[model samples]
Target chain A: MLAKRIIPCLDVDKGRVVKGKKFQDIQDIADPVELALRYNHEGADELVFYDITASHEERKTFLDIVEKVAATINIPFTVGGGIRSVEDIYQALQSGADKVSINSAAITNPTLIETAASKFGSQCIVLSIDAKEINTGKWNVFQNGGRIDTGLDAIEWALEGERLGAGELVINSIDVDGVKKGYNLQLTKTIANAVYIPIVASGGAGIMEDFYQVLHSDIADAALAASVFHYNTISIPALKNYLVEKSVPVRSVPSCQLY
Target chain B: MIAIVDYGAGNIKSLQIALTTLSIESTLTRDETVIRDSNAIILPGVGAFQDAMHQLRSDNLDKILQEQAAAGKPILGICLGMQLFYETSNEGGLSTGLGLIKGKIERINANVKVPHMGWNTLQIRRNKHITTNIPDQTYVYFVHSYYATDIDNDDLIATSQHGENIPALVQHNNIIGMQFHPEKSGDVGMQLIKNFWEMVS
Candidate 1:
């Protein structure tokens, strides 16, 4: 049986991890590589490094961080945020990222998804959608960090992304992001049912039960969280044990000494 | 030294990085001489079967790899590289492979997801050198839409379930293949790499 994945997302700016707080054991929590290694050791199925750096010059530093993380960890990781073109995707993958996630650029230029998927297999092209519930049971895709509404139906956009050759979809619910309540199960389940590719549920993961509810219910193939993991609100091993107790199959946290 | 056969199929930077982390020297080269001189060869690929086979044949790597296998030089094929070891693949049309293993590649006709992309436990079928020190039901990462079917039972070393009995690992004498990307499979993957290195050494 394929095990459910637990992912830790890190926001990187100018090569340093952002929002990384409350890690006394880690000498430098700001170091993306160090944090990534910490996650890998704790049995994170994959890692996501969102390059939130805005300056073009600082983007080079983000790529450097990608290289360092790639060299340090063996688990698959995705580099997302600010990926605008096929050239950007190529640069990220060339710098050792297994996959690159595209958000706003994908909405503005949907063909970018097709071109990138054709150039660098669909398996490496991840379509990340930022969605918010605008009306009863209706969600709209948002851009620019949920500031602008694109008016694209969340489910429709997910279907289009799959049709456009996106191998996976990361559906992030803006309403539930950082809410600590739970994942927008209705929204994620709707999109997951609409698409054939794997759907990664993002934004709302407050407790280990939130993960169990989303994953065990089969609403999402993987659950990605940032603040909870970054702040030590939820430790990965303990979470996996909880999931296992709930009969949710998860990869056992392997001893890192083998490597 | 290991020569990673490069035919422009997929990004092999992670594979090189993994080898470096294992303190093993490797080079990504299409040059026949470099491949011939290396202690072992790691065939890493990601893409459709026909396109990859096309690139290999165009660069004369098909014949070179055949010669290496004939000479008993250990060869490890990862993902699509492993698929190329079969006799035929139906992806992108019915195309021939290296024919080192007796099987044909076909789309996974299972109820689950098409691309079985995640960590799955291995069911070691037979004891082999590659399975050394590896625990039974060990988890490894896999990402693919097709799988090898009708393979000889003797060559099957391990299997993983994903709506069907997916061949996770196979070996026939000096030729070995893994349907998953060991480089991205975390510690168990690195252990497999180390074991392969030990076999070659």
Candidate 2:
């Protein structure tokens, strides 16, 4: 049985970990590697480091942070943000990352996904969609940290991503980003059902039950969170124990700190 | 020193990190001289069968690997690298393999998840070099859409329970192939690597 994954996303900027209310007014958390080791100890299936930067210098720092986190965590970790070319994906993978995620780069140059997939295989490439509900309930894809709208339909983009060899799809609900109401079930299902690749549900995980509800459905193979984990609201071991109680099949937690 | 063949397929850092943690001295290389002189070889890949074959052929490293295996130099194939060891693969389209083992690669049934992306326990069928001390039902990480099939030989040392019996480990003397990434599979995975290193040493 495939284990259900619990991932905590850390937004990296200038080598510091930050989480924002809907990705705005960011608040500094701990160092990226520090928080990563904590979760890795707590039995986190994986970690995602989103490099949210607006400057080239800061982006370089994000790579440094990624290298540090990759060194710190024993589990699989993914890095995304400001990646625009095949060389960027290669550098990230070579820097010790197991996966390299892309958003705006894929939307701007769909060929980048093809090139990266061809070079590094689809398993290393992840397509993250920042989806926001527009008027009348149609979902729109957002870029530049959810500030600029690409006007591309979320479902259509996901389908194309799969066609272009995206190994996984990360459906992040913009409306539910930090709202913690719950996952956007409908949107997640739409993309998960459309693409044959694995789908990871991102955004809107407030409690253990939220994870239960979202995973019970066929929407996502994994769920990602940041604040809940950073604040230590729900420790990973306890959460996995709860899921085990609920009969949610998961990987056996490492009995001790692997490091 | 061990040599990890880098033909531009997947991440080699995890394996390098694992090797370093174990105090195992190894080099990530594609140069034929370095690989041929190494004590053992670790061939890792992550990609479509055709693309991997293309890369291996283009780099002319395929011949060196075959020669090493022929010389009875222990070679380990991790995940996609293992798939390439088979005779043929039907992933995406039918493609030729390295013919190191008598098997074929096929896609996991669509009814089950397209990519078997997580941990599952190993069920040892026949105890061998890789499964010498690995307890039955010990879980290891896996991530792939295709699986090795059409193997009628008893070289299938272990199996992992899925919707069906998926081949977990298959070994033939010095040449061993692992369907899972032991390097990324934590301690158990490291144990497998350490055991291999001991064999070649």
Candidate 3:
């Protein structure tokens, strides 16, 4: 059976990881390539690069970062944020990313998902949804970095994205994003149960038990975290060790040496 | 020089980079002359089986591959490229493959998730050049919806469980196939690539 994946998401801006406050504020933690290499050595199953840059030139810089990271590490990584078109997807993959993730662009132009999937295979396209609860339990899709609610039901959009040829789904809850409490089990389970593809539970991952709950709950094939992993509050190897003790299958190199 | 087939399929970059990391010289070529002239060939792909076969056939690269394999040239196919070596595949319809190895690609049983996307431990069945020095149960990354089954036990090198015993690695004389992406599968993957490169070098 496939081992559950533990992903460390790096929110990058101008080739450096943006740290501090759930991906807010300008704080450079380390070079993206260096950070990715560290994670690779520490036994991270995969990595995700979220490009938070603004201009066209920055996209080039981000692609360069993706190339450097991809070359340095052997594990697969996904590049997300600001990917608007098929050309963007092409450039990202050409620069060495295993998969390109699209968020707001998929909402604005759903055909982007179809065209990308058809052109590059569905495995290369990942539909990333930023969901926030508007009513008691119903979640609405958010755009432009979780500011604009698109009024589309989260679950409905996920199914549509799958129909349009999305191979995997990444559900990130905006309400508990950086709270460091736990994953939104209700929101994640609802989407995971509905979709056949692998679902990555992002946001609100704090303790090792948090990952345990989501990964074993059949809600997430992978659990993604930024702050906990980025700041070393939870080392990937230690977390994997804990999961191993808890009987959760994780990809861990028993004798791995980390810097 | 090793000819890394450029069939307009995916994952050519990472394979090229993996070779570069090993200090091995390689050329990404679609030209038959280049492929015929090279000492070794690496067929890297990631996508639907039917579309990949169509691209190979349209460019006549399929015939070139057959000739090279027949001429005793060492060949290594990764991911979908490996699936294309079988007799046939059920993906996107019943598409024919290179038929170099005796097997058929079928959708992984519904017992597990589709695209079985993640890392899994390799269960080494035979000690071969590819599995040399690679520890038993060492995890390797995999991402695919279909797998090659009904393979002869003699050609099978290793198997990984994903609701079933998936053909992780296989070899028959000069031709080889790896179901997982060795290029993206960390240190163990790099070692396997180096071992393959050494076999021909």
Candidate 4:
């Protein structure tokens, strides 16, 4: 059986990790490679290095970080944020990234998805969307870091993304982002059902049960969290143990002999 | 030294880095002499079958690989490279493979998903050189749409369930194939790689 994935997303700015708080043991919290290896050691199924760098000049530095992380870490990871073109996708994958996630670029040109998926196989092209609930049951796609509403229906965009050759979709809820309440299960499930590809639920993961709730319920194939993992609030090994206890299949940590 | 066959298929950087971390020396080369002289070969790829076979044939790596396999030299294929070892692939029409393994590559007909991506536990069939030190139900990363079917039962070493018994690992004497990326599969995958290195050593 396929194991549910637990992913830890790191926000990088000017080649340094941002908001990497509560790690007294780690030598440098801003170092993305060190932080990534820490997550890998704790048995994270995958890692996402979201390049939140504001300047184009510093983007090269972020790619350097991606290379260092790829050379150091053994687990699979995705490089997301600021991926605007086919060249960017090529650079990220050439730097040893297993997958590249595109957001605002896919919305502006949607053809970028088709081109990237064709140039590089669809397995490496991930369509990441930032969605916000506008009405009782209607969700709209947001771009530019959740500030600009594209007026595109979230479900329709997901279907379109899959049709456009995106191998996977990351549905990040802007409303619940940083709220730490829980994942936008309703939105994630809707997208998962609408598309045949895998769906990764992002934003608002507060507790371990939140992961179990989203993954065990079969709403999301993977649950991605940043702060909860960065702050050591929920260690991955312990979380996997909890998930196993709850009958949710997760990859066991090598050090943890519970299996 | 190991020669990682480079036929312009896909990224093999991570595989090189993984070997470096293991203190194993490897060179990504398409040179016939280099590959023939190397102790072992690692065929790494991530793409469609027909295109990959086309590249291998164009580069004349198909002949070298078959010759090396006949010479009884160890060669390990990963993902699409594994699929290329079979006789034929139904990926993009009926394309011929290297015929190292008696099997055919077909699209996964499981109800779960198409690509069969992400981590999946391996159900070890029997103890082998590669399965040493690896526990049963160990998880490995996989990212492919087609799988090897109609393989010899004696060559099968392990399997993973993705709504069906997907052939995760196989070995026919010196030639080994893994449908998953061992370099990206964390500890368990590293163990499998180490075992391969041990076999080569």
Candidate No. with top lDDT: 1
Q: Is model 4 an incorrect, acceptable, medium or high docking prediction? A: medium
What is the C-alpha lDDT profile of model 1 across B18-49, one tens digit per residue? 89889999999999999999999999988888
TM-scores for the candidates? 0.97, 0.92, 0.96, 0.96
lDDT score of residue A127 within candidate 4:
92
Write down the worst ten-residue block by lDDT for model 2 chain B: B128-137
TM-score of chain A of each: 0.95, 0.95, 0.96, 0.94
Per-candidate Cα RMSD to the true structure, in Å, reads: 2.7, 2.3, 1.9, 3.0
- TM-score rank order: 1, 3, 4, 2
Candidate 1 docks at the CAPRI level of medium
Candidate 3 per-residue lDDT, tens place, A142-253, comes to: 9866789999999999999999999899999999888889999999999998888899999899899999999985889999999898889999989998999999998867
Q: What C-alpha lDDT, on a 0 to 100 scale, does residue A28 get in candidate 3? A: 81
i-RMS of candidate 1:
1.1
Model 2, C-alpha of B117: deviation from truth (Å) = 2.5
- Per-residue CA lDDT of model 1 for A170-214, tens digit only, reads 999999887789999999999988888998999889999999999
Better of 2 and 3 by TM-score: 3
Residue A92 of model 3, lDDT score: 92
Best by DockQ: 1
Off-target runs (Cα >4 Å) in candidate 3 are A254-259
Docking class of 2: medium
RMSD (Cα, Å) of model 2: 2.3
